[model samples]
Target: MKLPTDIQILEKIYKAHKNDFEQYENDNSIRDNKIFVRVDLLKIAQELKVDKDIVFGRLYYHLNHKFNYQNAGNSHVKLFINRGDYGKDEKGHEINFPYMTSILAGMQYERRKYQMATIIAIISLAVSTISVTISVFL
Candidate 1:
């Protein structure tokens, strides 16, 4: 079977790895990564017309949990916003282009497991595997 193209792979990776990327943003060691989260929340606020404060409050809590930050206070949020890694590489290279690169990687990994499930379902004449994919992804 043919493998997915880079774009397709990235799309899948984006879905699966979005959480990790979010954690990356709140991690001071990776502060440059914060832009992705910042813009993402900004877009949500713009589109939903939600108050920025509320949106930030919610995002802050989520970020704190995901990043394992012991302190879930304004200071931590501020630090993450101001000094967290912005998804940069060791060479100070920002991986901003592949916003969904991590998700795509995860999708590729899941694809094999999914394929196996498909084969199993086909052999067993069970439709659950296809349904599972559709339900989870769609």
Candidate 2:
């Protein structure tokens, strides 16, 4: 019933909702799996018994270009240009599904940045604690 923090997690919750029901007639494919497109956010919230804002925030975080809403109407307004990762345009630009993986990866590049930072912090903390202990003893 708890709110999902990230898009990938939210997607999992959506799938769970889809599975419990029997009326899903269409699907949105992710890799080999067909993630159903028939999403009912209100129903999902009711089923999970979570707050609407939390679920909505999760949905908005993803569908709104990963919170890239700086410009009020920056995204494609026309329906044809809003094909997303589902089709090819006139220029043969085959859009691929960049969800789950790409959004999380991005061009940030530093994959293990947090792990390295944590190691450095722990080392510094230990060294400082040792220095303080020595000064106290002295």
- Per-residue lDDT of model 2, residues 25-124, tens digit only: 3432332223223334455567657765555545544444543333476653210112233133223111112332344454233436866898999999
Candidate 2 deviant stretches above 4 angstroms: 1-3, 7-49, 61-97, 106-112, 135-138
Q: In candidate 1, where is summed lDDT lowest over 10 consecutive residues?
A: 88-97
- Tens digits of per-residue lDDT, candidate 1, 31-128, equal 54443433343434444455534444443444324432235554332212312433431232122324234434565788888999989878766567
What is the alpha-carbon lDDT of model 1 when measured against the actual structure?
0.44
lDDT of each: 0.44, 0.44
Candidate 1 TM-score over all chains jointly? 0.27
* lDDT, model 2, position 38: 31
The parts of candidate 1 lying over 4 Å away from their true place are 1-37, 45-59, 68-104, 111-119, 126-138
Total backbone collisions for each predicted model: 19, 0
Clashes in candidate 2: how many?
Answer: 0
